[model samples]
Target chain A: MLSKTIKTILTISAVTFFLSACSTTSTPDSATGSSTDGSSGTSGSSATTDGSGKNSVNDGVVAPTATVFYFDFDSSVLRTDSRALLDAHAAALKASPRSVRLEGHADERGTREYNIALGERRAQAVRAYLVSRGVTSPIEVVSYGEESPAVDASNEYAWQQNRRVEIK
Target chain B: MKKVMKFSIQVIVASFLFVSALSHAELTISITKGVDNPIVIGIVPFNYTGGGPLSENVAAIVSDDLERSGQFGPIAPENMLSYPSLPQDVVFRDWRLLGSEYLVIGDISPTASGYQLVYSLFDVVSQKTILFNQPIVVARDGLRDMAHHVSDKVYEAITGIRGAFSTEIIYVEHQKKARNYRLMRADMDGARPKVLVTSKQPLLSPSWSPDGQSVAYVSFESGRPAIYIQNLATGQREKMTNFKGLNSAPSWSPDGKKLALVLSKDGNPEIYTLDIATKRFTRVTKHFGIDTEPRWTADGKGIIFTSNRGGKPQIYSVVLADGYPQRLTFEGDYNARAQLTPDGKSIIMVHRRNKVFHIATQELATGTVRILTTETDLDESPSIAPNGASLIYATKRNGKGILASVSLDAGSKFALPSTSGDVREPSWSPYF
Candidate 1:
């Protein structure tokens, strides 16, 4: 029964996505139109030349696609692979000064409150890295502990995926 | 994208069932293990002389309570040779033939405004009345409470220990499919559950006050984690902490005048005590490592918390006067979420051995360790009963979170499975 319900929900979400896409395409000045082509920087630069200047901040800069950074078990130290992506995020945040929220999470192994503290430590680690990178936008950190899991499983792979901080 | 879709589906389903779930929310208790040689007890069906049937089966409730404690085995009513509601009507030979070592008899008589319960507990072998003609009068809706009272009395009379059957418990139930979280209060046996607070965000670390009139917990209802204290009687809530980084793990002191909680506003997660009235925060631990999960000692003279300053998470106690932390657990590499037993001799905590988490108790003085739960790989948040005979904790069964209880001696065990969703973080209330 649960799987069937999930299937129905997936189908409905797909339909809703398609309908919303159609509605967006029908609008004349839909902001999502330029971003959907994956060449937002080029379109934004042309629009800036057209004197709109609203998209000038993002003219030649590509925002980082990676928002989630994984951590080792019970460790807040960032991985070497996450640095390049975080550098891109720092550049983007510096270019456009928008508030950022860092949500930290942990795997379901230790006690919850301890995990909450661990999650906060992970988020703070990321916040410290971003601040050190000269990104000065307002940064907020929240720890979900193990209460919310990206993948609801108990294996090592799931744990690795769940122990992460999302830059939202 | 998939996560967003799942979350939206959860919100829809939760809103759809919100009304029905409120009216009938409860956790069902299932006894998985009992003592090897449980004491045989016979409970006669209480005679009701009221005009109509009573709302609760007093004798049956009492029987279940005793049996669930794992110390007593109640004989089936069909196996009894006679149903006697009075001490004079109990025949020792009949009960002995039925293999009942002790017997309980009770009856309900109608009163002008409510009902009167008269009960007795007898030792079958000695043919002596242990508790004779104990009368309790209650209003119409308090029959279950009255039955629990009878069970408490009988349990105490036989075991030489105070019974916690009449006490209450608070737990958090999370419906992952619906993204709903509810902080619930219920009888110790998982009956009469009522929602104390509900939110779409997560709630954790529910701590009962020393007076049992209010509860302090961490709620993310306002989009960030903060500590809140809610009066159980008035349903009034006060946001106690709105710190910047983290405000979680609120534990009331033994004196109920202050709350020991974790705050990260200063920098790292550190233990701090907040005066209930003055609202002053006194920093207790000054360490760079993560220091959280602060619990008051029985005397309220020190705070026991989990810290990794020594490299791994271990239980530590910090004296209030000197502010020096003493390590408590050395047997395990992982020990967090510690709670002192009522007598303050032993500490119960989530002990991880061989990468599997289980609830274990360690003596504070002798450093002796006893593992209480061995059946499950993940057991956390163990809350001891006021009498310190048993404890309830959250463990996963078949990938679903459920509340389970085990005796301190590891002789008896039972699981309280929620009817709706996953239940965790059970806080056993103090005796009323």
Candidate 2:
């Protein structure tokens, strides 16, 4: 009984450490510049001048919070904006040394089995990007095809969101 | 405590209704378009002489079956001049006056075991009895089946083609809110629905074995996709593929000895055949591009699949001996999910024209493409009947998935009744 209690405490502390490490390693986005540095005194303001004479408030060193990456219809080519976020995730995986799961999805179009292949292609693209970043953690990839949608609607916006790969 | 009890009662009642719905779900068909000059046939009500009230109106079912074929327009019983049960009672003059080219009469008599049906078909135009009294015996609960049997016989005698009224269809129904998916099997006319399997995750790509004894489908119940074959009679399931990647689109070979499926274990999706007896897989296609949705050719010597090797998805046929894939379709920017007709003369596929997905058929010898569906922009997963007369496919109606059927000539069209949730991936079974 005492050993089980100690194991539970150890698991809690380990999870806390892992989460903290993930937050610290993620890179902040330039578009949604969430300032992580409170010493800059620009937390409430929309715009602020930085050292490089730019109006962006973020230092561009904070961790990224976006894990879901979107793709075009019937294509698996990753967007340019997703590169920096994936790099942050790669950094987190390098620091924590944990297994990652990449779940791929597709919009509700085309034949179902073909969509399964398309989803896997997206997931494989993400896996390749992470691997190229020198991350050694084992990555498992699975594609749900067009079965599970991020949004239940059947519009263009929903389709864009549904064609994505989520990192868990 | 009282509120909890009330909620429990409601839950029990709701679950009971759900089970009942699964078992008794019947697809009501509405004919959108029919043949221009349908042959009119007059069917007299079958005279039933059983111990108690008959459970099913056998003659009505027969009339419905024949009418749904789009080749025969059954005359209503109320309009019939006489109710005939035998050849002697069928007045050729009366049917000719009613503008019916043919007449059908039947009688159901109670037997020691159950019942015996004696039916006859008469050619009103020729003024001769084409089919003599044909008798079929069935148990008490098989009135519907007995009706379908009579319809099949009459249909073949008239159209010279074996009827598919007695066949069955399998489809997947998904309840999005509950995250539940049920694989259902029903009669060809959508009656007596029975659930084959249910899962919390998604189920798709259901294919029937050639013998109609078992079905193969891809299920994600285990948090990942895997192919499974379930016996229709015993409800026993066997996991056919459990590879690290996709194991989907399991198409039974014509001989039923092997299954052609897609597996991505070797870096990307490719077609492979699994020997059922030996449990060995032989890679059929060796391509870096995505080759998937593999369907066996009618001859079973080659496989026709969807591949994006030429910058876009198109139908391709690869012979097992040569391992060389020859492209078959060239007219469409997107053509996938290729299913050959029973004659193997043409390929039926989901084709895109003007960015609208429709079911189209292409002649292999002439490269002539003919589009079949024009009602909806999202029609897909076309499964042809064994007789090659009609095909059923999934289409979206008001954002809800439903099944629709169209004759090969694109003359007759009908939509299956929409269930509570979405229904997709319809697979018409081979003749039982």
Candidate 3:
């Protein structure tokens, strides 16, 4: 049984998942906040706070776009919306020589070691997309698997929040 | 169908949660807390002379060791009629009247460079000394080890099976405060947890070699997960495998010449065996679905692994000659991380029934699956004791990770918990 805080966080995450899942190009300005922040939530909340705001494209540098990308269960194939998000990130990397690390993670289900492979594939897929886009900035990938999660709840919404790749 | 039982355990947070020396807050297992059809016994407090602060008591440690095995029920000191340090002082009638089937007595004395442990095990029924004057020498700081060795000898003399008390266990603790993940080793009684490795990222799936000289585990220290074999004594390590995708779940073969591992380097995850000497690799399973958690059968003829080729994850074994796997589990919709017992008679894995994940055993001959745990949200990673009498696994208690044990037959359960923080990924070490 999930605590009240986790249940509420999952409900909010489910709403956010569906919203982001439907959008084509989730602009960073519009997609900046999700109630499931890293500290209370499982994902990279503290990492995003340190990596964002000043570098966001809408800060008059370029077009603001989403950094974190979500995928379907057990599938590392980048989603259509994630492609658009990655394109913007690739553009940001192309404009500057700044390096970005792709942090990968998976839901807390199945065997941990296998989920590690899944997390690696997810982040490597994002790295492949950025590197293939001719972005000169160095890109790195690290898979946390189900270790550092975004949603503490055990439901599907929470799992979806956990199975994501954060571009840092 | 997954039933969720909600239960809470009081989480006592210790200030020194993370420390360099594992003794900072050793795991204290309450062996006398749970009751079963336990053998009633009495262990007299060990006699000591010229003590330079003996770190542990031999007789008390032996009692705790036997009691924790879930096979022995030790009588409290208050219940004992007399305290005896030798077999001459121990009266059979006195122990018989106290309802103790066996008795233990020991003496410890500090020497110039070490301590001497003299222990004895007696049969209360026949009033005969089973083990007498078992002498052990321990250099100054090795009193705990001497006690465990005595525990080992007494246990074997009475039970006929070699005791695993002197053995060690390797487990991982993933937390926020420390290096995020720590690979640790401790005594079977949950004492002296020494951290072997620490990682900034996640570390999982720690497997020990047959000789207990080294440990091979998956670490993300190089940024991504890769298998590394580290010498336990020298602290020297070598990256065994650093493939492109997945290099995890490394299990050493019984002979120690080969290692069966899970890798996704070729498409999806598959079981592969790596020759330790030649640096050769042999693919064991050919499957489209997720195939992982490959463990060597004790005989070394085949490898048993978990695969989802049949639509749901189940146990399968592949004979090394043909490299063809035969399904061994048909009872449940989900069964993963299957580990064969030392005798090769059964398989222990995380079996899900009605959606509740539990540690279960499947008799290979009968194909009969039996659930070992009753109430828990998620219980997984069932590592069988080297003696095959009990199992230690990671389970969630009050929303935190803790290690729990269960007797294979009696189903008695107990938790070996840390003072604070979550602990998981337990891998029992082989006998040294």
For chain B alone, what TM-score does every candidate structure achieve against the true structure?
Answer: 0.93, 0.93, 0.92
Off by over 4 Å in 2: A1-63, B1-24
What is the model-wide C-alpha lDDT for candidate 1?
0.81
- What lDDT tens digits, residue by residue, belong to model 3 across residues B41-131? 7788788887354555556666667666666666666557898987678888888876677898888888889888788889897888888
lDDT of 1 by residue, A12-97 (tens): 53343233223322222332221221112222323222111224346455555446777888888765445544555676776777
lDDT, ranked from best to worst: 1, 2, 3
Clashing pairs for predicted structure model 3, backbone only: A42-A149, A42-A150, A43-A149, A43-A150, B1-B354, B2-B354, B2-B355
Taking chain A by itself, what TM-score does each prediction score? 0.66, 0.63, 0.65
Native contacts present in candidate 2, fraction: 0.72
DockQ of 3: 0.29
* lDDT of each residue in B320-374, candidate 2, tens digit only: 9899999999998999999999999998999999988999999899999999999
TM-score of chain B of 2: 0.93
Q: What stretches of model 3 exceed 4 Å from their correct place? A: A1-64, A69-103, A120-142, A152-157, B1-24, B31-33, B51-53
Compared with the true structure, what per-residue lDDT tens digits does model 2 show for residues A63-148?
Answer: 23456777888888765444435655665565556788989899988888899999998999888877765678889999999998
The C-alpha stretches of model 1 lying farther than 4 A from their native spots are: A1-58, B1-25
Best by DockQ: 1
Tell me the TM-score of each prediction against the true structure. Answer: 0.86, 0.86, 0.80
Rank by TM-score, highest first: 1, 2, 3
**DockQ numbers for every candidate?**
0.59, 0.57, 0.29
Model 1 over residues B358-404: C-alpha lDDT tens digits? 99999988999889999987899999999999999999999899999
Model 3 chain B: weakest 10-residue lDDT segment is B7-16
